[model samples]
Target: MSKDYYKVLGVEKTATADEIKRAFLKLAHQYHPDKNGGKDDKFKEINEAYQVLGNAEKRKQFDQFGANFNGAGGFGGGQGYGGFGGFQNGGMNINMDDLGDLGEMFGGLGDIFGFGSARGGQGRRREPQRGSDIEAAMTIDFLEAVFGAEKEVTLKKKITCAHCGGTGAEPGAKIEECPTCKGHGRVRRVQQTILGSIQTEASCPSCGGEGKIASKKCSECNGAGTAYDTAKFKVRIPAGVDDGGRIRIPGYGEAGDRGAGVGDLYLNIRVRPSDKFARDEYDILTKKEISFTQAALGDKIEIETVHGKVELKIPEGTQSGTVFKLKNKGVPHTSGRNIGDHLIEVVVKTPKNLNKRQKESLKELGI
Candidate 1:
């Protein structure tokens, strides 16, 4: 074999399952492509090693045959077969469309174990699918985001048809078993490919895989069980949620096809700029201007914070651009446990015009 999985993970062959898992996790964190300075090649190598060695049954086979084990009883007698000999079995007909979904793992000489139908327009239906998730951008004021607020949002999307009650059948319509696939929801098809003729089971086209048909379709949704409608609801914006943050509201997205399941609605936050305040994460930033005398002589002044107004003491000889932190005065954390500090930047304003007497006051003290 070209690579050793145990050596790649820096673990012994005799390592326990927990040890293998820990080693994989540690290396995965260090080389994950999402992290800074991460190496993609190394990450892929680590993942490949773990895929075989991490499984109990696969590991047992790997221990016996090393990395080159490929089912087929280890040696290619009646075992591995030539290129497409495995397809000789009546149960192993390949679906050419789903072949792309298999990717490099099973591209050339491998066969999918059992009944397999990858996603497609006429593919076999295994289970009821959930509706598609929807995302929308929501703009809120800075203060409204700092402190949670309730706002209304108008959404235009698919909803269950009121007339049909999501059944795709009009009230009092006669429902009968589909005649095309004999109520099986699927039918067999033989297609000619480059490899040869491949037979696959597909969803019945007449009934759209429902296994039943309505004598009279719903007029509102045209028998699809869903219709486009407008809905308005109030959403609670969480406190301390930063701009570009996403909030998920469950069961608010488009209704699922044929009433299968609903999806979630995601609101992407966009905070409007504030003229009197700025933000650095959870901290609230505000600038306060004071006269030169207050900076030199010291004074107690009121500062406005997100919570409310509070008094702050400026020490004597305080310089311009000095920032004071007010503990627990900034925005509340989304968790509601921790509160951030309010940062106040003091800007000292110098007197521009001075009278002769005012200027001479400094000279009189010297004279």
Candidate 2:
């Protein structure tokens, strides 16, 4: 069935160019192949879908062609328009002048698909690729999050075997072309349907889609070219990085087979709760308790800041819930801005127990 491009991009068909760009960017960031695990095909599909729908002229042609537009064939296969088999096979005979700006769009898709003009020849496949990215969660102390700290984390991941150099073969061993797909890495299955013969291509199961078979497999990786290793690394928590913020550590994730670059590691941060202070942007909030006598008769009180103890004066008759702001005494801003203010809320504490003599003295003063 023909996929709906607008639906793929999560936008209406009548969406404007700006709206289409915004929607594409959001979804692209969400499902980018480098970030989203187990969704690489979906990411590629949406990117291709948006490439055609984001443009006006291509959209018009696509709307005109309806379901007959063969994205795999790079458009112009007219099973919808007046029986004009559209362009010739291999998309070679299509008139470049008619495609207009779509040439660039197709060119970009070709880069991803490794089309004829790409480094690989027609139907030529590239090397085995990197593994998908993985996400992990880490918790740090609030003070560490504010001041930035380095931590060592250990995770079990697959890494290319050092014994065989990721080729999955014994030392100095040769690789032979796969017998299943005959070095194609993919095999076509033709289904005889009511309309005609429909061919579908699937990865070759025998060679695992690599199109090459190792003569002797490496004992460590068992021919998969990767092994499980306990990866340990130091992760730097940047100052002022808030909770739920992500830190991307590239090339520290799972290793790829056949010397492919390692996948990326994503750390989802969680800040531990602070007992004495609360964070608000770059500001810190705290509570201070004072005696009723101190509030009634103004006095100097000592309070604790992240820095140290500081003396603050309380005015006479100071009410409860009064907030005092201390400038440049809060968390540091990541952008190098001035330190935020410290907000201290004062609460007057009443005496809970009094001796008989104290009670008598109070009664003599009041009664």
Clashes of 2: 0
- Clashes per prediction? 0, 0
List candidate 2 stretches off by more than 4 Å. 1-126, 167-169, 174-217, 335-338, 351-367
Tens digits of lDDT, candidate 2, 282-345: 8889989998788888899887887677888999999999998877888777776667778899
Compared with the true structure, model 2 gives a TM-score of 0.55
Q: What is the C-alpha lDDT of each candidate?
A: 0.73, 0.69
* Residue 130 displacement in candidate 2 (angstroms): 2.0
Give a tens-digit lDDT track for model 1, residues 236-283.
888988899899989989887667688889999999998878899889
RMSD of model 1, in Å? Answer: 8.9
Top candidate when judged by TM-score against the true structure: 1
